[model samples]
Target chain A: MIDHMSALFTLGNMQFLLRGAGMTLLLTMIGCTAGLFGGFLLAYARGSKGTLTAPLRWGATAFVEIFRRIPFLVTLFLVLYTAQMIVPRAPLFWVAVVSICLLCSAYMAEIVRSGMESVPAPQIEAAEVMNFSRWRITWMIVLPQAWKVILPSAVSYMVMFVKDTALASQAGVFELMFAGKALANRGLDPFLVFATVLFAYFVISWPLARFGRWLEAQLARRTHEGDRR
Target chain B: MAHLDISGLEVRYGTVPVLSGIDLAVERGELVGLVGPSGSGKSTLLRALVGLVPPAAGRVVLEGKDVDYASKASLRGLRDHAAIVFQQYNLFQNMSVLDNITVTPVKVRGRPKAEAEAEARALLARVGLAGKERAYPDQLSGGQQQRVAIARALALKPALILLDEVTAALDPELVRDVLDVIKDLAGEGITMLLVSHEMGFIREAAHRVVMMDAGRVVEVGPPSQIFDAPTEERTRAFMSKIIRH
Candidate 1:
């Protein structure tokens, strides 16, 4: 029988996997921050009215549709391969991180658009009549209410983002899944290495999943109380 | 010159004309009541005067300045002169009553925060909502919400205020409270153009009554002449139906 702890800890293999886990966490943080910011711009462009913003709205819609239809792995490979042709010596880590952020942004754009749609028309009209500039109305009145509607779903998307970082290994980045595979290839027990990787992922994802549920419960309670009044 | 003058005003939703060749004027400190059946364009006329509904063809001249709807600066200046309270009492659900009353003055007009708050408190008291300053809109009854909406409009200190079926959304018991507040405003000599189905209140409060039918002004006269001695056939028919109902 294979000794699981010995296989995981021997020859600094555990330390290598821990570094990979750290890289995964780092990628998620950077990707989510950039993705969420880009997604907000996309949401505004996609949902804006009038003939002036038509081209921007159309471009945002096309981007979302194209990215959402393509599989994440294919998108990652295409972005990386195209990028390598332009900057042959560019770091694979940045290429993978940028690709992941772009992919996550397309998904988040739809989430944000739906949240914006959930705000009532009269509320926006009220702001307009009060002589608020368009941006002030959107930033202060619309987004505050939209954020409440999107908070739980946005947290869940972050959890999905954490798992998606494993795809960075396909681009030759040394993330958690890549580390486990490399250790197992050295004739170490595959089960022990993969189990450790799984545990590491759960450590990161479990809290996010719980937090999403907690937010949903809190929102539901507030809505219920609002209805009672 | 009239305080508010609308000449050759027109509004359309695509191919359907809502208001056509409408001309009306309100003098300073006069209360003009607009009485019409549903879809007669009374509400659209009020909305157009405030630049809410862009006029298809017309001029709204307020205090000798012809409103230029295409220009943002012109619209801003127009908003300072006029405000509209809708049938739904569109209060900001996210703000407290005090914030709702003070936000435009503090944010748009650059009024001092403490001064705006003090005025808001006084307006609340005038509207009979003295102690409900911190309450959210949902926490108030429909009547109280409408009163708060009136106070919010009053906070802007506009030269003219428009009321478009402001009591239409309230309960029967709640309607009286809102109308009472409007009565108090009429007593203050504020220039008002009120579109209402409350015939009795209109006759009681309005100095002149404007009758509209199918997007056209059919008659304009004192309440006694419009209600008791309407000369136009359409006005007589409209008034008789309303009185019977």
Candidate 2:
């Protein structure tokens, strides 16, 4: 039984949570930025019509399956603990960052692969006739269209990225969830503190999910209108 | 010299053969139309011509030089001379119409940006899309998009251009606008190989018509002969259906 009252204006607590929220945002932005680039490389390598394509696909698949199967908590524990042994006084924050990036990239790679494949075959043909190199064709043509086509899904992935950052608090990196836990333990009213934390997450993530849905609708409307025209 | 010549061309998708034992030639500045019902290898043949679909067993000679697909350098040399327009307009959808037309010339052809934009603007004007320089593909109509494709192809000043059913996707009313652009392009002396279902355009615009059926050329002659007085039974049957429909 959690009371959803009085925690909003708790000045010291709100500031602490806000600071943690900042760290959470930082973690997601860094992780997703790295994940986007990494995922693209994996997706492109896997999908290319080259001899190395199969091997690269297999390697990426293995990485995804292994990471996705192992519990995130265990993975973080191993990475944080092992990394600390190798280099004491190193930033444990990096371990959390790397873990989130690796997990998100595995999923984002599949999203990007779908985007790449959706580009019409003729588009590449047109590029070839214009004497465009593979690199030029990729950067100048394929990637731009794909970025647009995959945007809604990518935004959803960003939302997932933000939610995933909360898990990093287990690595002792102080973020929103950790901040909430600290506040709850200090106060006698655990339910009030936790309910406020839940509300705070909704405030952050609901907008992202709503924005993604709105974007998807906007794109669909344009496509339907184009067809009608 | 012949602009493009293919001898014993063959293409396959996995174990399924799409084009086999195909032979064709196009002289400089020739306008040739390839017509066939669906799945007649017309598109496959056009793809083969531009090295998009490499032959399983044959040589494509461009200006008397055999296209060696085994060598990247040779293929790059071959690509410089040809441009392709697709059945589905393959405009880079994220870019403005002007960028779609000028990107290859500026980036791939290594022309200065100002020079490429100048040439691209002239091409857009030639295609009657003079004011659509900043419109995105989705903002334009299908006919407009197809014209952008034509302008993009022409921007390269290619020795040979392959148009694969460029108007297949347009509305019936919009079809003529695109074909009219192609007709105007021919008047400018650009060598073009077209695969189209627009029989009227073939009859009026083509200098020569090549009819393909079941992965082979069933007829090759002047459009009048192919359309009005076909000698082959298969050709007559095809024409009869079009006329009846």
lDDT of 1 by residue, A1-229 (tens): 3576765776688789889999998988887777777888898888777789999999999998888789888888988888889999878898888788888788889888888878887667767877987788778777867877777888899898899889889888889999988988888888888888999999988998999999989886674233445
The alpha-carbon deviation from the true structure for residue B201 of candidate 1, after best TM-score superposition, in angstroms, is 2.2
Off by over 4 Å in 2: A1-22, A52-54, A64-70, A81-85, A88-91, A115-121, A169-173, A179-189, A210-229, B187-189
The candidate maximizing lDDT is 1
lDDT of 2 by residue, B109-150 (tens): 788999999989998998889988988888889999999998
**lDDT (C-alpha, whole model) for all candidates:** 0.87, 0.82
Worst lDDT window (10 residues) for model 1 chain A? A220-229
What DockQ class does candidate 1 belong to? acceptable
Worst 10 residues of 1 chain B by lDDT: B87-96
- Per DockQ, the best of the predicted structures is 2
Q: Chain B alone: TM-score in each candidate?
A: 0.97, 0.96
Q: In model 2, what lDDT does residue B172 have?
A: 91
Q: Candidate 2 overall Cα lDDT vs. reference?
A: 0.82
Residues A52-84, model 2: lDDT tens digits:
477877887787667767877877888888888
What is the Å distance of residue A87 in model 1 from its true position? 1.8
Candidate 1 lDDT tens digits, B1-245: 88888899999999788999998888888999999889999999988887788889998899889999878789888888788898884787777899889989998889999999999999999989999987888889989999999999999998888998999989999999899998888856579999998999999989999999899999999999999999999999999998888
